[model samples]
Target: MKTNPVIETLLSHRSIRKFKDQPLTEEQIQLLVESAQAASTSSFTQSYSIIGVDDPEIKKQLRIISANNQFYVEHNGFFFVFVADQYRNQLIGRDHHEDTSVLDTTQRLIVALGDASFAAQNMAVAAESIGLGICYIGSILNDINKTSELLQLPDHVYPLFGMAVGYPDQDPEKKPRLPHDVVYHRNHYNPQPSRDALDAYDQAVRRYYETRTGGTREETWTGQIARGLGNPYRKALKPFLEKQHLGLR
Candidate 1:
């Protein structure tokens, strides 16, 4: 298959769990922030803010809050907390004597969330292209309330996920992805998947993990899904969002 450098880089993307103990230079950090800012925003609102945490004390607190139980946070050159922020827009409206409560609606919250997610992905791609590695710490949601408080976030701002970026210490093979046919629909939604197809996919995923872990892990994709979704996850998310003045509509 013919591919360019961008495609190749994306295809090789993997979550780096281990990173070299070296900090990123100021120039590199600036470039990453610039790349994130270059991402597209909803209606030009650009409702996202990034907090780069470098202080050892703050990073330690965040790692504990995340419950990620990983070394990436401690070793990563920079850990970024992406925040979905409508606060700036709300303040702008207030300055004009306009009611800003409308910004508390779920619709606006979604826009800010999308803006933050897009910015994170842009930075991730840029990092991969530059020979750096990244790992997203979604477990930060484990304690969103505490996370926000610790970050000293104001109203109209909510913590999304964090990214740990540094030089890779390990090389992992690319993991398998599901077939495109089931993922990409013609126009509308097509949700049905044949048992045989799913079984094949499950087997493929099992083999991938088994190989990756040197036979230590023999888990399947569907099994992981079952374990992940069977129980409640981050039940506090909704309440946390509401407290942040997001998704309150």
Candidate 2:
């Protein structure tokens, strides 16, 4: 199929870890936010917020909380915290003397999360189109409680993920995704995908990692899944979510 610029940009996506020592202009920041705001929202609720962090002290605090990758945070770029927020709606309900109980349910939480994710992807794509590389920081969930406290997050608001965007210092190949057949089903659900296809993907993943890391981390997708899922991760997030009045239907 013939592709357009947008499709080409999407296809060339990569998670950039290293970044050059440069700051994004205010215009770029505004454009990124505008792009994010243009994403589809659930019921037009716009149940999301973005916090751009530039202070070194705050970045240090976030770096400590994120635990794994701190490269971009330590450098100069735009670090945005995408927040899944329903707090505004809660307040709106209070002003209207309306019941805000529905906002505390799991369904509403899902909506808010989807809103935040869509906004983040829009910002990411826009940033990439402007020659900025980006990486998502999910390790912040390692200490979501502390992160909330540090950010002074109110009830009905949760930090979904952080993104670091800057000029690319390193060029990396686009990571492989699952095959179209495996991911895209026409109508009915296909629970049993071809084992051969999965095995081939595993090999492809292994080769990608090996070549990327100079053979130091030659691991298959299955191996990564096993390791990543082997231990309990963010198990405390359930209580955290309840404390934030989310995921509690």
Candidate 3:
């Protein structure tokens, strides 16, 4: 099968959980930041900033707050927190002697989030291209107040997510993905695929799981989603989002 470089890079992507305790070179860090800045911004606002946290003590505290994942603090050499920020623009407005307080709208917040996410994904792809491992830490949202206090985020700025980067310690098998038709649509949106289509996908996922995990555990896509949604972690996301001054009326 013939493939382009971009397709090949994207197809082989996986989240690297384990990493070697090696520091990233200054050149590499600069390249990552440059690549992140190249991503398209919403209305050219570029409402995002990345915090590079290298302090061991701070990393340790973040590790505890981020689900007690010691790998984040002990293993990874560099940590980055991506923030959705309108604060910079607020300052721009202040310099121009204009009001910047009206940026508290839901639309503005979403735009900032979109900008941050685009930049993060760009940096992740760039890191992967250089044989570096990366894992996104969504669990940073688990304690919004503490995270905000630790980062000293101003109003109109929120930590969207975090990324831990280093050389891989181990390479796990690539997890299976849903069928293309399930996610891809034609001109317009379809309700969903037929039950038979979903069943075929479930069987494929089940087989993939059996082979990948050496028959130790089995799971279908629906079952996995159901299990995840059934947990208490699912309930707190919306309220937590609200507490962060996001997604409000």
Candidate 4:
């Protein structure tokens, strides 16, 4: 396969759950944020804000809010909460005496979400390139209201997710992904995917888990997806977003 240094880094990406006890230097933090800022934003709105959690007490609280399962939240070099924020733009519009009703629309919310995600991915790649390991903590959304309150977030701002970056203490095997044929289509959408390819991919994923867990886990990708979707989680997300004055339109 055609590759370069950047492609190698991207391909070798792994979630580093175990990080060394060392905290990140301020210089490293600045570089990571600069990389995030370099990501493309929608119409240059830059409708996102990154909150670096340095307070030990706050990290403990966040670990609790993450269902108390992800201890790495409080033990990383640094933690960041990427927020989908339109509050800044709202203030801008208010200062100019212009209508900011558009900021509350679902369209603007999507734009903010995309901007935040792009920024986070850029930071992740940059961190990896600098010999740091990172893991995305989406469980921060488990209790969005409590997270918002804990972080003291304001109206028109929502905490999308958290990220923990630090020096690696352990190396884990890369998780298997869906096959190319199942995800990539030529032109039109391929509603009917090849079952043979899917079956092979499922077995590969099952073996990956089995080997990773020493046979304790042997579930396939399809089974995992089915279990995840069997019951809807976070039903309060929509109401919570509306309460934040986002996606109200």
TM-score for each candidate, following the candidate numbering: 0.95, 0.97, 0.89, 0.98
Q: Per TM-score, what order, best first?
A: 4, 2, 1, 3
lDDT of each residue in 180-207, candidate 1, tens digit only: 7757788888879667777888999999
Lowest lDDT sum, 10 consecutive residues, model 3, at: 233-242
How many angstroms is residue 114 displaced in model 2 relative to the true structure, after the best TM-score fit? 0.5
How far is 158's C-alpha from truth in model 3 (Å)? 0.6
Candidate 4 clashing pairs, residues 3+ apart or interchain: none
Best by lDDT: 4
Residue 203 Cα positional deviation in candidate 4, in Å, after optimal superposition? 0.9
RMSD of model 2, in Å? 1.1
lDDT of each: 0.89, 0.90, 0.82, 0.94
The true-structure Cα RMSD of candidate 4 reads 0.8
TM-score of 1: 0.95
**Which candidate's TM-score is highest?**
4
For residues 1-249, could you state the per-residue lDDT of candidate 3 as single tens digits?
899877777888888888887999889898999999999999999989999988887777777778784565546858899999888888899999997655766888889999999999999999988889888998777777677778888866788888999998878778778777788899999896767777888898898889878998799988988898867753455665565555465
The superposed Cα distance between candidate 3 and the true structure at residue 35, in angstroms, equals: 0.3
lDDT of 3: 0.82
Q: How many clashing residue pairs appear in each of the predictions shown?
A: 0, 0, 0, 0
